[model samples]
Target: MSDKPLQRALGTTYRAEMSCGDLGKAIRQAATGPTPGEHTLREARVMQASLTAVGKEIEQQQEPTIAQELRTPVAAALADYAQDTGEILNAVNDAYIDHEDDGAWQDGKTVRMSAPLDELIDVLRALSQSPDAYADLRAAHVRQCAVGLAAVPSRAAGPTYTAPGRNCAAGLGYYDGIAEDIPDSQSKQWRSDVLQRLRNSMGTPPAYSTDPAQHITASWQRDAVRQVKVGGSGFLTDDSTRILDIWATARGDDLDARKLDALQEDMGSDACSRAEETTKQLACTREPSKCP
Candidate 1:
């Protein structure tokens, strides 16, 4: 007679109705007999009555399953977006900082390039174009620059650094021509010279020669390890869920099963503890003096 039993019966009927497209017929059939793997009509009625008395119990147990299912994808999506955004912003800030400190760009009056900053500018421009594209590209650029810098032969006087975009004479010649042609009062000859120098030296380094991928990959790998150690707090905070999703997807079934098992175990343990506490409370209510 309780609504819970009736609601459960109606739910069963509704599902049948959806499949069969006849609510009246489904309800009548449900009332008359059991469906496959379910109780008979009489037994179902008894079960439904029992369910009504313990509906809240069932709901409490079921809530975590629903919460976890919903949380997994949502959390992963949020994490991925955050990591991508952070990577782009970090790369841009690094580039700007490095450019500001370049010896050629300093002194405020003279602009000289031990190596041209144009390539760095190009990398920054590429990153500034879109937030999403920047992470991989910035990683690539950083690795490449690091490798190139490392490859500089060791000398007694520290390491000699070669500037990109500074070695070409044609670029300098063009700047000289531009400087001579511009009227002294109207011309920014020094600016023209710098521009010419940049034009001459913009060459793409050999892909095999530079290992930005390795450096970037190594850096991320180390961070990932650290994050895992800190109970995933840093990784979660950084929104690295997408990266994890990618890793999970690539790893196949074993990892997926492991993840699900861990979640279930955690939920199960918490549920048991909660149930025991609730039982104690209920017992105390039944006999106040005996509770002690």
Candidate 2:
């Protein structure tokens, strides 16, 4: 035999025998990239929508399982945060409306609203600084301002009312002016912060072989628990069957009674039979006293 071929064969064997630890380390290093936080705001927005959907699903379930229960608090928190954001937006709108229509403040006449704009600005500033507060307020502020502006008559000159001079127009202008400066980054940051808080509330998914593998494992584990609860001869209860049906529909799996029965029969026959055979072989090979 040629020594070169033998050397090559030996090299291949050596490579195969190398420790999996080094291979794993190399793979991880290669696969590692930017964190989810680094994703674009638009991408984060899409992710937020998906998270919201999952949250809604958990909320709608009549009786939550352990996993659902764990997710519920986080979802509720996010929902509450969203509501707070709306309240803040409404405050901003109210402040703008109150200031905009003031007769004392002239647009270009170096006049200001009668009510204190400073206080509103302070609240906005505070909200921007606090992640929790911002999460509760940002969306609401934007939405309220946008909708309120849309509903109000435009400051254009028309038959019903004459447009004010530049000075008066300037006061009205404050509402639109203040709103335009809200940074996209701030909005994105608030969203990111809320999502992070929600994720923290619900413990991270277990580290498994891969993301998809982890999802599969979780799905199966949930299904298995449902099966046990529902199929137990003595302990089977209404709650158990409801859980099974809910999971089946949520997973998009058919839950026909006949199909479930067929699957149970197949699995029991194959798996139980194989297990029994293995047990019998082990028993037969062992010394009776030692086996006992």
Highest TM-score: which candidate? Answer: 2
**Predicted structure 2: clash tally:** 13
* TM-score for all models, in order of appearance: 0.18, 0.20
RMSD of each: 32.0, 30.4
lDDT of 1: 0.30
Question: C-alpha displacement of 159 in model 1, angstroms?
Answer: 5.0
Per-residue C-alpha lDDT of model 1 across residues 220-284, encoded as one tens digit per residue: 33443334332211111221232233223332443445543443344334333433443343334
Residue 26 accuracy (lDDT) in model 2: 26
Off by over 4 Å in 2: 1-213, 220-250, 253-256, 287-292
Q: Candidate 2, residues 121-240: lDDT per residue as tens digits?
A: 322332234444333332223223223222223332232121111111222222222222234556444435543432333323343224432333243334333342312122111212
Which parts of model 1 have CA positions greater than 4 angstroms off?
Answer: 1-129, 154-217, 224-292
The lDDT per prediction is 0.30, 0.30
